[model samples]
Target chain A: MTTYSLPLSKRKRAVKTRPPRDALFIAAACALGLIVLVAVAAAVIPFAGDPARIVGPRLSPPSAAYPFGTDALGRSVLARLLEGTRTTLVLSTLAVVCTAVISVILGLVAGYAGGWAREVIMRLSDVLYSFPSIVLAILIAAVVGPGQAAVLSSIVLVTVPLMTRMVSAAAMSVAKRDFVTTAKISGVSAPVILFRHLLPNVSGTIAVQGTYALSVGILVEGGLSFLGYGVQPPRSSLGLLIQEGGSYMLQAPWLLFAPAAVLVVAILSINLIGDTMRDRLDPRETRSLV
Target chain B: MMSASHPDTDTAPVLELREVSVAFTSGAGAKRRTVRAMNAVTLEVAPGETLGLVGESGSGKTTTASVALGLKRPDSGEVLLLGEPFTRSRRANAGKLQAVLQHPHWSLNPRRKVGESVREPLTVARRDLSRSEQRQRVTEMLEQVGLNPAFAERYPHELSGGQRQRVSVARALVTEPRFIVFDEAVSALDVAVQMQILALIRELQAEHRFGALFISHDLGAVERVADRVAVLFRGDLVETASTEEFFRNPQHPYSQTLLEAL
Candidate 1:
């Protein structure tokens, strides 16, 4: 065969360009990375300051030795905050990971295997979605009897519905794309087409949705703990800290502020990271944003 | 090597569609309606011959292509590929048939690189080829279509429309299929790029001697690439003739009108 090119070489060279990266997006990603690293460190390393130790006077203000001040139990607020980050991050990550795994399977099945299977899966999802996630988590936690396992499972249950719905919708649209049909006509096997073509196309959407789910999972777990239905005494969850600190809000204030700040930071970082990913992954969103 | 070549002798046609019909039904009971998409469209692409199926937008050109590709099973008709009864399950002769669809941007998966897309058929159908052999074949096909081997690493979006079309051609021909359906493959391209793609397709078809069903609306494009041209108007094939005969002397009134319109 002859190698005859259309006089497109010059044009191709002319159009050699890169998509501009947003500074704000870069900053948010860096901040999120730093937050994740700190959380991982807190989870892995033993804290030098004893979170449960009564080392100082109660209701103390922030100081060099006890940064973030002391709680009602005269325990170091800094230590408790680190331990709480570990607890929150671990539970939220587990819940999000479980929700993602289950949702991906259900969503792909619902979207690709359209008809009675799709109808059943979607109806099940609808039943779960009808209830507010927090209320659903609380109800599940209440039923299972308060413990860490119960809290984790409840958050997973609460999140799976929304994640599945998003993934299914994304999969359906991706399934309709010409490449899917192209792959089909090439005599590619069904499983190969599904896992290779359909799954990869929808994965960006899944990642973005999963990040959003992580933020929600954290909030739900915190709410459950605050209500005395999650993470029983001595586990040192951020929500439990807030619960214990609520009564002495007027006096110390630092007790509530310490854990509250960490929780807010975690949620905010995840949301920001998720938004950045969505913008980058979906060209339509990026176009609209520009 | 297959008995499909040499149409001058009495051999089986590379592709044959006999009285194929497709109708879409809508609504129920009192509001029922049937839209006839294709009406007994009988056509054939001889071995090593290019048959251009030309028609307006709703003239059932795409429907004809779909039937040939086994994408949509016709309501009633006998379709044959390589002298075998064309079943919807095409796995028995997978890589022996292929297609180069329109919209190169959409035809190629966005998540995959060009090399993966080009070598997909071989990967799925030609399990005999080693990984290195497949890579070599991909690069060779890319070169044949006037693209660099480096293009293997680039995603579809990174390439120009013409370059992407080249990748599409490489993919279609990679399997060395005896029959290929090019559904308006160059229509989406600019005039210059269209000519280059047309030239490249004709060149490759000449080298491989594969029977081609080139579906397009462009009269000049069809005349340039097709050995025979079939005109469709409103779900029915109006006329078919050798390229010279059709151009010099159009018989049917619809064909005359279509030529005049062109």
Candidate 2:
């Protein structure tokens, strides 16, 4: 029994180049983290200043005492923005989490089970997908009535179809692989195969899609709130704050600028993160990134 | 080593395919087409015997293996494992049958550690074994496949093609299945690695005494590992013979042509 060694050129050698650092990814992650932290802090700390409290003269411009100045109701713009951050973040996060959970389960079942299950799930999602997302969200929010639940459900409904589609595609490909068949041959139960084998393979897709869903969810929440079907008056969401600020945009631009700036930054950060994650998670994209 | 003539007439075959046929339909309506993938192909593997199935591409070799592994339900006929009827729905006979597919990259889950993949069969079928005992068996099985026990902690991507194939074998054999299918298991590796794997398969088969359906297009590989040879052509089982006799004087024209190409 003799061993044969390949020629130097034929043998595979590891390429040890370090991956290039992505400055945009780092910046976006940090910004998103900071926004989340501020939201969390506003929620947990009792002394984070009342966003609803009347502070200074109504419609005051930016001053030393008040960074973001006062809104039409004399509420501290900065404080309202922070509180709005909490509301928007919480609602969107909840919706995105629900979307992820529900979509992943549905996607795995549809992809792995195939046959009629695939047809039913995919066709249902297709029907939901046919409507303009905003219109669908508005209809649901209108029917459910203006509140946090309406906004949450609207975002969940709007975002779920796309996320489920992404996950379903990933899971379908993974399900076709030999490892999945091997798991089946080994007698692992359907649930175990779905979770243990199928889920992990499609998780990268889920994570990447989740970031996009989060951004979309925030936008939907804002759209719903802006139209008066989301978080109601007195309790400020970014969308509601922006809607209020819109009327006084000519007199004091900061009223609109303050919340709109935060909203833009939040959405940008999430989108950038999603893009970077897509590159990192996909093997084909990793080469170009490096 | 078991001789080619050693008959196990006293015991039931570890695996038997009784006139198995499979047809796949594609498209819809008037344009629909049905392709007969397997045409009532019947074969048998005595306990501890290595039956090599050789064929060209699209010769239904994979379909035959799929039926034997119970991955595809034959449109007609039955598959028996350890003298019991085996079907796609029979969960009771899960670990009794297993397979080593061609591409090791797809055969093992990329996310799971080698040990976890190898331990899955025991955990699923041999639930009586304790966790530690199962882990111990995984370690032993890795060694049996010529892998270091430490390889268990590593993911599939960390290993070379040959090493991954070895892990695939370890995962397949960990349950000590009554019968196993090797569907072009060594076709993906380099020549040296292919020989090594073939040798390992023979050695493992000797120790475990499990029947094997070794499917490959490589005649040289088939001759090396398989005690008996079966040739398939266009969804039909054209010839079956002892490995020595088949290589010496092939009866079928297709078998002779296959040998000529080699």
Candidate 3:
């Protein structure tokens, strides 16, 4: 093969320097850490009103009296918010990661192997995707029972189809590159080629999709929790707190306002991270922007 | 008893293609159509001779090298190496046949150091050479190809176009493959790099005494290094002779036009 060497200056760094650790990663990681801290505090804050702590009239209004206002049981609104953050973080993270892991693995295997295998796996994904997202989650939740397991499973079922198809396409594209062909001709085993060439090349898709699945999982789990079919009471969630605050919309709108704002911030930040990651990972984005 | 510089070497062609034809499928889906990438073609190369396969793109120059190296299957042609056809040789015999491609940019894995890429042929052959032996071989191959041996630690991207191609050539030669395929291997290189690579190929051939099928679209290059030249047009064997004869007495209309173009 005819080979070209970059001059000492050019060759030393033809590898695009990895974009410095992404800002979105740092932001998302911080958000995740905050959620975990709140969850841990909810469970072991050693206070009677940490979500377990109950006081004031059931529907006390927001004031120095209750920063988030009292619920129906006069429990501290801030306590419920903290506890809700814990539940939301735990369930959404699990569901999102689970979907991403399962789908990306299946997609890489199917697309990289291709032929009959691709047809079978991709067909199954199509069938799974045909069901409406919430309805599918609801159906699984109904069977799995209206709790965290039910909610997470439902979301996973709904989200994996989208992720699998996207991952498969990305893996297929990477697998077919000239570099991958060279790897094959070098007598590298199929498995090594899959991991070394295919997966690393398409990790951009994985990161982009992971963030998306996470946001959707959070929103969906929150919606289910609000409907009283997720996380369970006493566990508390931003969704449940929002649902509770929603009923007394007039006396203490802050009850709804607090949870709704948190949800928006959480989803918007995650989405922003996903978008930024996609832009940074894909040189095409920079090209188009220029 | 593998023959080493045997007297019979002058008798049996080191590599031969008996009626090789390459058919390529074009279009997509239901519109798929098959075109003769190469028609019934036949040629042979004696050991230590550089037999050049010259053709335009899609004329099956690359395809010829591919089949000769067992990279592609011809629809109904025989690829004979060392007097025995490729089908007759054991697949493990692959170490005897190697190919160098044109796009040096994509030939080596970008992740690997040059030494690793060059040692790949031996690695593939399940060779038990010591690490030092392999390293020594790689260094010698690099220097032999007119590249700085210090490039051993470098990645493919670190080298210029000519340097990468030399690295690839070193990789192919590491195992001492008796038959080598050059699939338009020099066409993509800069003019100066092309001459250096061509000269390197000639020098390596003389040292290793291996037969080579040098595929290229450039006729000037063929005249420089090729002992014999075979002209292919639309996959048909248009002309085949010693480089001097082909240039002096152009028989085929396409060959005449191509010679005039260069």
Candidate 4:
């Protein structure tokens, strides 16, 4: 780069990989994107092979036509696997976004207001946090009856408290700043201050947390379905495939093995992407990138 | 630097803090201790005059300025701006007074443009200024602080410390207030830049005739610009006298030692 172009060149490099590449973040993004596309395609295109069809010869091993082979129900494992990808995508995504929205609002309000209001809100969060979310989800699932909506809603309820607590912590820190006081002194309304000044400053913190939520949400959905509380019956998910696969391990492991492999890859990818975003979003992270 | 640099010896007091005290409880649970930043310190700043509040580190000069600005309420005592009680009750009138804080890097929000920052207070007052009028005022104020108008669109990080401080001064001046509590506004800049800032402050103060509560630890620098000087020691107003009298014939032992240390 010439002397005149040096600063712009540095900025361009910073925009790409100013710091050395993190193999993990790239892999994670690619994996997550692939899984999401699988889910979206599942929702849109109707499969020619019936996921529930019991046509292929039972106990057939992996070959050219039957890649994932057949399950105990004699269903084409490959068809079920493709359809299950859609369920996993829908359940986890809805649960995470719903949890995030509720938590962010509560956190912002509790953190900024402080005093008696903060105490009440924080105490409420603590009380909710005492229960293990998986167990809480099971309990909620029982009340709502077994299905995808019940499973997702239960997971959302369990995860939101943690998200709210993180949001409030960041909000409270920024609320005490001189700029906030300066904003108030300037007579900007409370809502304007909350969304404009305080929110933008705390976005890096929230983006990091949201990534973690996506990873954990997938696991929670799997656990629910594995226990028979999630994605019931004709509906398929990675958790359902795993549950169904556990039965015929010795005879045909591929039925359960294929979906389980996808699940592990999906979770790993999400976590990597989350950590990468956390690094990138942090303003302090720029120093090393330089 | 002499105390007699100020020719306005008989200017009337425009701002006052009557035995103002500010205290806070630090830490949590049983480990907490009561911290007193300003302890019953009475002081005054004359109209169109500069009263230097000189103190060593942790002497609570900034705390006094905070209380005066209506940002922090004193545990006791009262702050009077222009002979009116300035407490939680008179918050609306607090706009007549403003502040220029220390650490130019932290003083302005980097995420915001300079135009929005400079036009902030006036917009808050619901001044129906057209965009052109606002632009004109921002330009004039920026120029008054020795900065070009084009600088208004840049982020705070893009500017040097001296330029940032100048931006902060423009922010305070854009409000067009009568009193400004300068709480270590120039402390973080280089000595050369500090002189430029001090001279600019003196020029602006004389031109606008705004009373200023100038806080600094440098008695030598204080002597150059202040009309009267108040020396603070361990949260107590050790001495308060006209700038010339305090430097020429100091009565308090702490004030005498403080003068000697300089």
Model 1 chain B, poorest ten-residue lDDT window? B1-10
Model 2: residue B6 alpha-carbon error in angstroms:
15
Superposing all C-alpha atoms, what RMSD in Å does each candidate have to the true structure?
A: 5.2, 4.8, 5.3, 6.5
10 residues in a row with least lDDT, candidate 3 chain A: A281-290
Native-vs-model 2 lDDT? Answer: 0.86
Those runs of model 1 whose alpha carbons end farther than 4 Å from true positions after fitting are A1-27, A44-48, A112-117, A283-290, B1-10, B26-33
Report the lDDT tens digits of candidate 1 across residue range A159-191: 888889888887776676557766777888777
Candidate 2: residue pairs that collide: none
Could you give the CAPRI-style class of model 2? acceptable
The list of candidate 2 runs beyond 4 A from truth reads A1-21, A45-48, A283-290, B1-10
lDDT of 4: 0.77
- In order, candidate lDDTs are 0.82, 0.86, 0.76, 0.77
Question: For model 4, what is the error of residue B239's alpha carbon versus the real structure, in angstroms, after optimal superposition?
Answer: 1.4
Model 1: clashing residue pairs? Answer: none
Question: i-RMS values of the candidates, in order?
Answer: 6.6, 7.0, 5.6, 9.2
Cα lDDT of model 2 by residue, B1-262, tens digit: 2223334464579888889888889999998998887888889998888999999988888889878877778899888877877754647886788888887667778888889999999888889999999999999899989999999999887889899999989888888887899988999789999999999999998887889999999999999999999999988899999999999999999999999999
> 3 or 4, which is superior by DockQ?
3
Residue B211, model 1, lDDT? 90
User: Cα deviation of A274 in candidate 2 (Å)?
Assistant: 0.3
Per-residue lDDT tens digits of candidate 2, residues A1-290?
01112322332222224344489889999998998898778778834478878978999999888888998888888888888888999999999999999999999999899999999999999989888988998899779887999999989998889988888887887787788888888888999999999888887888999999999999998998999999998999999999999999899999899789889999999999998787667422332111
Candidate 3 per-residue lDDT over residues A1-290, each given as its tens digit:
22233333443343255455466678866875676666576577644265666777878777786777787777888888877876787788888889888987898898788999999999998998999777777788788889989888977887898889888987775565445544445455667667766676567777888888888888888888887788887768888888988998887787888888888878877887787777665322322111
Docking class of 3: acceptable
